[model samples]
Target: MTQQKIRWLVVLMSLALIGLVIFQVVGVRETLNAKEDQFDGSVTEALDAVAHKLEKTEVAVLTSRRLAAERRKEKLQQIAIHDRPAKTEPKGRKASPRKADPATIQRYASHSPIVQQWEFYGRVTVPSDVLNRTNGTLTDAEMHYVEEYYRNESPPLNPDNRLRSELEKTYDETMFRNLRKDVESVKARRDSVGKFLANRVVGDRKAAPVRKHMPKEAAAKPKVTFSRPRVSRIDSARLPHRHMTEFEKAEQKSRVMREVLLDMFTNDRPLNQRVDMAILDSLLKNEMSIRGISIPFEYGLRSDDNPHDFIFTSSPGYREDRLLDGYSMQLFPSDLMATDNMLYVYFPERQSYLAQQVWTTLVSSVILILVMASCFYVAMSTIVRQKKLSDMKNDFINNMTHEFKTPVSTISLATQMLSDEAVAASPSMLNRYLGIIRDENQRLGSQVEKVLQAARFDRGEVRMMRDQVDLHELIETVVHSLSPQVEARNGVMHTNLGAKQSIVTGDEVHLTNLIFNLLDNAIKYSGEVTDVSVSTASSADGVRVTISDKGIGMTKENLRHIFEQFYRVPTGNVHDVKGFGLGLSYVKKIVEEHKGTIRVDSAPGKGSTFEVWLPF
Candidate 1:
C-alpha cells in the first residue's frame, strides 16, 4: 500500500508539474498578446492623427494658392486697362508724338487696340473739308490728318469694331469701302507670326526673324506697331460649385463623412460605439448644409479598412490613405480645395485579434496532448511489465513438463517388460525396453537443448560468427538431413534451386536450423503421401527461399498465429499428430535475428506456402 501510494504521488506530482508549465506558458502568451494589442492601438491612433492633420494642411495650402492666383490675375488686369489716349493730341502737336521707344511703342500698340488705331489714323492724309466737318477739326491739315489716319491706318475702325458713342462721330464710308481687304491682311500677318513662333521659336532649335525694308529716313528710325486685345480688371475663373452636379455633390459628401468615420475608428477608442448609419447620414447632411451645398448621400462605416471600401467620391475626387513611417499613414483628397467639398480619410488598422485567437487555441491543444501522452506512456509501460511476468510463468510450466515426462516414460516401459513375463523372459522384450529408454532419452535431450537455446537468446549470449555461406550448399545440406523423415512419410520432395550460387552472411548453423524447421513443419503437418516442394531464387531485395506442402492446409487466420510461441492450428480432422507448437516461432526468431521477414499464405483446402525474404 505504501508503494502504491508513492506511485500515486509521483503521478500527481508529474501532472501538477505539467499543469504549472502550461499555465506559465499560457500566461506569458496572453501578456504578450495584450502588449501587442496595445501597441497596435497606439499605432492606429498615431496614423489617424497624422492623416487628419495632413488632410487639413493640404486643404489649406490649396485654398491659399487658389486665392493667391486669383489676386495676381486681378492685378494684371488693372495694369492692362488704367490709361487711354484722350481723343488724339491737340492740332499743333507733331501729328502723333513719338513718346516711347520703338519696341515700347510696339508693345503698347500690341497690347492696346486704341493705340494701334490712333497711329493708323494719324499717319494718313485726307481731304480737309471731308475730315474736318466729321471729326470737329477746323484746318484743312487737321481734316487731312484725320482723313489720312482713318484711310491708311484704321485697323481698329473696322466694321465689326463699331464703337458707337453719344458724341455722334462720322466718317466717309465710301472711302473705307475696301476695309475688309485691309482687315484680312492684318489677320493673315498675325496668324503667320503665331504659326512661325509655334513651329520654330517654341518648337525648334533655330528661328528666323521677320525683316522688312524701308527708305533712308524710315530705316534710320524705324517703328513697328502691333494690335493687341484689351485687358480688364475683375477677371473670373470657374467657381468651385458651378461644375458640381447633384449626384457628384452627394458622392463628395458621403466620401467626406466616410473619411471622418474611418478617422474616428482609428484614433478614438469610443468611435465604434458612436457609429450608426443614421448618424453618418446626418453628419454629412449637416456639414454640406453649412457650406450651402446640396447633396444626397447614404453614409455608413465599412467593416474593414481596405482602400477600396474607403471614400467613394462622385464629385471632385476621393481621398486615399498612403502609408508613412512605422505604422503611420497620410490621407490626401484628390480634388483639393479646387472643389466645393473636401474629404479626409484615415489610416487602416491591421487585423491581429484573429491571429492571436488561433495561436491561443493551438497552444491549448498542444498542452492537452502533452498531458494525455504522459498518461498513455505510463499505462502502456505497466501493462507490458505484467505481460512479461505471465510469459515467464508459462515457460516454467513447459520446462517442468519436459523434466518429468522422459523418466516416467522410461520407467513405464521397464514396468511393462516386467508385467509381460513371457516377453520379459525373451531377449526381444529386453530390446524393446532398451529402445523405449533410447527414445525417452532423445526427447529429454531435445527439451534440454530448447531450454538452453532460449536462455542464450534471452541473455544475449548467442553470438553469430558470420561467413559467406553458399545458400545452395546450405539448403542442400538441410534437405539431406531431412531426407530420412521425408522417406518415412513417403513424401516426394521436389527442389527447384537456382543455378547461380547465392551467398549469404550468417552463422551456418542457424541458417541450416532455420531451413530444417520449415522442412520439419512440412513433414509433421502432411497427411500420407504428401508432396513437399522447396525452391531458392535470387532477387534484388535478397535471396527468397520458398517451401510448400500439399497437406492439411491452415486457414488464413491460423496462418498469422503460426509463428507465435505455443500457437498451433486446430486442424479439423481427427489425427494422431501432437506438437509443443514452438518450431515456427523459433524459426521466426532466428530469421529476425538475421534481419529478415517470414510470411505464410494459405487458406482452408489450399496448400500452405511459406516464404522467407532477407535483404543483403
Candidate 2:
C-alpha cells in the first residue's frame, strides 16, 4: 500500500484499539459493579441470617433468666415456709367456732370480693372441704350481708363481718401476717434476681448495680432482714447442703448464686461471643466463597445509640468507620435488652476481590492487542523492505543489460568491419578487428562468470578447492590485474603487505576473486582520481586485510547494507558506473566459506574501510 494509505490505516487501527480498550474497560467496570452488587446482596443476606441467630440466642438467654428468677422465688418461698412458727390452738378461744352456713361459705368462695382478693394474694390457704360443704342454710340477713360484700358496698351490722371476726379468732393472725411478709420477701428476692441477671448476663461492668429494697419492719428486725453474704469461689457440687447450719446454708446459697452468676456473665459471655464470631465468619466465608470473593474481614458489636463505641470486637484495631470505607454490614439484636446494640462486619481486601474478578479478561485483552500490534509492525516492515529490494533489483537488471550490451555491440561492430571487402584486403586491418572481438568476448565471459558465481553461492553449491597459497603474492597479483583500471580512472592504489604470517590454505581462484571485487568496488564508488589503499597484518589467529578508499564515501546507513545481495548506494541519475550489485555480496560469501569475517567502518562524507580476517 501507499504510505498515505498505510498511515491512515495505522491511525484508524490506533483509534479502533483505543476505542475497544475504552469499551472493554467500561464493560469490565459495569461487570464488576454488578458483581459487587451481587456480593453486597449476599453479604446482607448472610448478616441477616446471623442477626436472626443472635436474636434467637438472646431469646434463649432471657428465657433462662426468667426460669432462674422463678426458681429463686420458689426457693425463697420454701425458706419462708420452713421459718414460719408452728400453728397452736388459742387457749382463751376454746369456745365452739361459729360455723359458716353452707350457703354463706359458697357465696364467699364463689363471689365475695374479700375472698377473691385473698385468693389472688396466693398467701391464704383455705380448706377445700370448707368450700365444698353444703349442709347448712343461710338467714335472710346473712344473704343480705353476702350480697353487700359481693357488691363491694357497706352494710349495716353485716353478718359477713361477724363471720370474718369469728374466722379470725380461729385463724392465727400473726401467722397470716407472717405469710404476707414471706410473700413480700419472695417478691423482693425475685426483683433482686431479675436485676442481677439484667446487669450480668450481657457482662457489662459499667452497668448499674442491683439495688436492695426492704420493708421498714424487716429493716428494723436485724435477724429477719435478708443480707447478701460475701461469697468466695467454691465447687457447688461438693457442698453438703442437707446437714448445713442456717448460716452455712445461707453462705452456700450465696456462693452458688455467685458461681452461677459468674459463669453466666464471665465464662459464658466469652464462649458465646466466640460462637457468634464463628458463626459470622462461617457465613461470610461461605457466601463470599460461592461468589469467589476472598478478603480479610473483621467484625464487632457497637451500641446503636453510640455507633462509635464498640462493646466487643473479634479482633484488635477494629474501627467503627472501617465498615463505611469498605464492604460492610450492620445487624441489630432482636432482644429488648440489647436492641440498642448493632453488629458490624468489614472487609479489608476489596481491591484484591475486584482484581481477581477481572484478571482473566484483562490478560486476554492485553494479549490480543499485543499480538495484533506485533503482526501489524512486522507486516509494515516487510512491505517497506521488499519495496526497497524491488527498486535495487530493477537498477541491477538495467546495469547488467547495459554492461552486456556494450561488449556485444563492440564485438558485432568489429566483426562487421572485418567482413568488409576493403578491410579484408589488408592483414593488419583483419588482425586489429580480430583483436577487438577477442577483448570484447573476454569482457562478456567475465561478466557471465561473475553472475554464475553469485548463482552458485545462492544454491549453496560454491565449494572451495582448498590449497596452500601465499597471501602477499595473491595481493600482488590482484593489484597488478587492477592497476590498469586504476590508471584509466586516474586513481592512486597503495598496498602494505607487512604480515609476518602470509601463508594460508584456501581456494586461489575464489581468494583472487574476493580481492578483485573489493578493489573494483573501491574504484567504482570513488570520485574522480580515486585514492585506494590495501594493507595486511597478522591477527591473533588469522591474517587481516584492510581496503580503504578516499571516494564518495557512504553514510552509516548505506554501510550497514553495503554487503547485502543486490544492494547498492544511490548514485543519482547519472549512469557513470555500472554493476550487477553483487560484488560485495560475493566477496562476503567467499570470505565466510573460508571461515573468515568482514567489518566496515564509515560515516557520512567520510571514507569507508573494509577489513577482512581469514584464519591461517
Model 1: ten consecutive residues of lowest lDDT: 197-206
Candidate with best TM-score? 2
- How well is each residue in 1-616 modelled by candidate 1, as lDDT tens digits? 2446646766786687678667766875676677567645654454354435545654454445555665566455444432322132234322211121334334434655433333322221111121112223234555456557856875655453343321112221322332323432331122221222111111112222323222455335434343653444323342211233332343344344433433332332222332333433454455445443332322223222443343332233333333111232333323221221222322232235334545666577667767766766776566554454456346546545755565676767676776787877888877888777777777677766765776677687888878887878888888887888788887788899973547888888888878987887887777776788999888876889999988888876786667766565665454345455566777888898889899888766567899997665
How many steric clashes between backbone atoms does each model show? 4, 0
RMSD of 2: 14.5
Runs in model 1 with CA error above 4 Å?
1-353, 356-364, 367-407, 410-412, 415-425, 465-491, 497-506, 527-529, 538-544, 552-581, 592-599, 613-616
- Please list the C-alpha lDDT of all candidates, in the order they appear: 0.54, 0.68
What are the per-residue Cα lDDT tens digits for candidate 2 across 457-562?
8899888899998989999999998999999988899999999999888999999999988988888878876899999999779899999997788887887788
All candidates: TM-score: 0.43, 0.66
* Error of model 1, residue 562, in angstroms: 4.6
Q: What TM-score would candidate 2 get against the native?
A: 0.66
